[model samples]
Target: MKSGEGRVCQNPWLNQGHTVEFSPDGKRLLVGSSGFDAVFEFDTDSGEVVWEWFAWDHGFDRSKLGHYVVRSEAKCKALEAMGHEVLLVDDPGKYEFGIPTRQKPAHLNSASYDSEGRILVTLFHQGAGYVVDRKTGDAQEVISGLINPHKLSRRKRGGYFISDTRRGKLIFIDENYRRTSEIALAGTPGIERSPQLSEYLQNTTELREELFACIDIHRSSLWLIDVKRRSYRGIKFPVEWSVHDVASLGRQHGLRIRGLVGTQFGKVAAFARQLKIIHHFSVDGCEVTALVLDSQDRQRQLDV
Candidate 1:
């Protein structure tokens, strides 16, 4: 395979690709650009542009459901004095963005296609997740009240696994969208192995009370990515990746790990390391395009 030589998309707004995934049939590639509100589709083998879906083009309402009742004008003035902007909008009507037809902006973080081919997406700012039927373009809420849900993975069974970055917990929801189980980083395998690691996790209790970073579920094992520790562990796989976000290469094949660690300058450095390979690569300005494994040892690309 040619290293560092591939077809590149020259679109400026689409330059920084955040995440990518292959369709189940391996015919198309889905790309998610975090900085923008669109997901791109491309041909898998030929790297040809297919179509782009813009979230803003859809009519989905992206407002929080609730109302702030102000008992008196003095209390409202006190809130305004604290530099907090208050909007006196009610539910349902709150979704309008000053215009009659335009919908409010939703900051979409990650998205995935479910078994029925419907697209499910996570909205960070709204703390809610939605499922959009690709055939009808109708998006409906699936879950809500999540604190910074970042990565989403489909389970082999029938549900979904959501990564709550802010709360540091891996939430497993059933098909009915009810939270089934939540795994914290305190008593897991990786932290249990080292005493120092356990102490650090205990210290975080004064701050947040729980240490959950990232999580991935394989066949029968559960892998955890610890943002606080800047490490990856097969909490159930019995192996460790250098980072987190473990994407399996194939059945019995090793895993690909990606993680972020804060540097001295207070910026996060993104690192990618393969499980079998000892050396890892530091992503400069580029984020992970996609991590997919074929039946053979070769890996494919779905991002620029």
Candidate 2:
């Protein structure tokens, strides 16, 4: 709530959390914890786990998943016996930095509920989408052969939309998991989105105006678009680093941008308007530190 202060709800199952969203009733928090290879629902008021769906519980084999589950107390002890560092499974930061990159099989990037009250998730490493029964935890692979898919959202009209990052395509699929259409990403040109990019600049209702924002990491630029007018304005930043994500701290505070020079060092900038830079800060390396608008509509750094 205060500067540099946050509420920490520590849970062993909340490891490497990728996507978190509130249920339609706004009482349950659904999270797709990639490291655990599972999706979970937690009670918002009590912080109690309502349900969890593990990939292995639904036909997946332990040999095919990430070893993050092994970070439990007993397993960590065994790993320490082998001269490995002991990082608790409850500490996602350790699993993120201490573990190897190969520990991902059902690398879930997004999770949401469909109209039928079923769970839909996109597995980046598996390049597939799965439909899971909310009550039974029974899952079936609905779609596959995608190139590093992310962001699964149910369409208002019908079907769903998912971002195929590696292929630079926004694929639309029917209820039966058949491809209906695909849109090639434009504006950024040859610059492709990365699976490592957890936060994305997309459409939101917070803005007072009907405008869309797109960031060009390669050029260090931001494009403000007005679809109704078919016009856009490009604002360039003074930094050479790649801007990963942006957050709006209301109209009075302007936009905040988060970027990294490389793997270790990170940077954040505040822009008032156009090309005007108001503030900048340097950050220590983390797996992913995102600029987000908090409950009071204030800017805050969230590590995921």
Candidate 3:
């Protein structure tokens, strides 16, 4: 609970962390690790497991008429090696499990709470989105035909905007889980609500009351714009920490791993309201280290 310099709470159980999300209650980080083939909750304070669930173990492979079952050649071989005749398609790219993208998704990309209270998550290396029953941990695929979808945030009025970086558009999902509309995006892959941004730049007549944007997290650079006015600027991080980490990073940065940035969760203090920059790092042979740099200074390391 201290700030000034960031902190570190190592949890080795997290492997191939595809998606890192802070719980809505803001207590634990819900990590989707493809290596573990499950999404697990870890303590924000002690880095201990709260609970976890594998997608395959939780209805990810349910028999649905419109849904296609996809498995990698390696997985099919692994299952066959285990004495199961797992037939797989010759071209996995066109399958539900595999999109037209380069990387094959295996776990999840991002998560958010839907109006119905279900935990909505986009599958890794896949073209589908799913919603999970919060209390039971059960899941069901809700949307399809998206090419490597990124962070999806619930809109204030209603529905949710799904950022499809690969496809260069945002698919709008209604409260009923239907793809109602779409928004065109160019270079940015991820987007998040910026309440503090609207408050800070109150004098900007072209800006709206509630701002949304894509950030270069490592440098803490923000691209604030007036989508309608066609006016924008590339500058320093938003002069506020409240909206720092609202949009969770997807499995592959910008729809690819090569250009990814940021060290997962940049603490904004416990619930991440306010945190300071720090200066330090440590590694013990084989443990994951989560690091964060202050948005303002960029050079100063924040809590680990």
> Using TM-score as the measure, which candidate wins?
2
Please give, for residues 77-121, the per-residue lDDT of candidate 2 as tens digits: 776687764435445544432222245445566677777779988
Ranking by lDDT: 2, 3, 1
Candidate 3 residue runs with Cα over 4 Å from true position: 1-13, 59-105, 114-117, 186-210, 215-304
Worst 10 residues of 2 by lDDT: 199-208
Q: Over the stretch 10-122, how does candidate 3's per-residue lDDT look in tens digits? A: 34434555556666665677765544345677676666777666564564532222232234566667766767544354452333222212222244555555655566676
- Minimal lDDT window, size 10, model 1: 198-207
Model 2 has an lDDT value of 0.57
List model 1 lDDT by residue over 1-304, tens digit each.
1322344442333422445666888577776544444567777556767766555447432334321223245644765787754433223233221211112244465666677777777665566777777776667887788665664656555676676655546667788888888656434443323343211210011011123334432212344444347555554432222222334344222221112232211112222342111222233423333343222223443232
In order of TM-score, best first, we have 2, 1, 3
Top lDDT hit: 2
Lowest lDDT sum, 10 consecutive residues, model 3, at 198-207
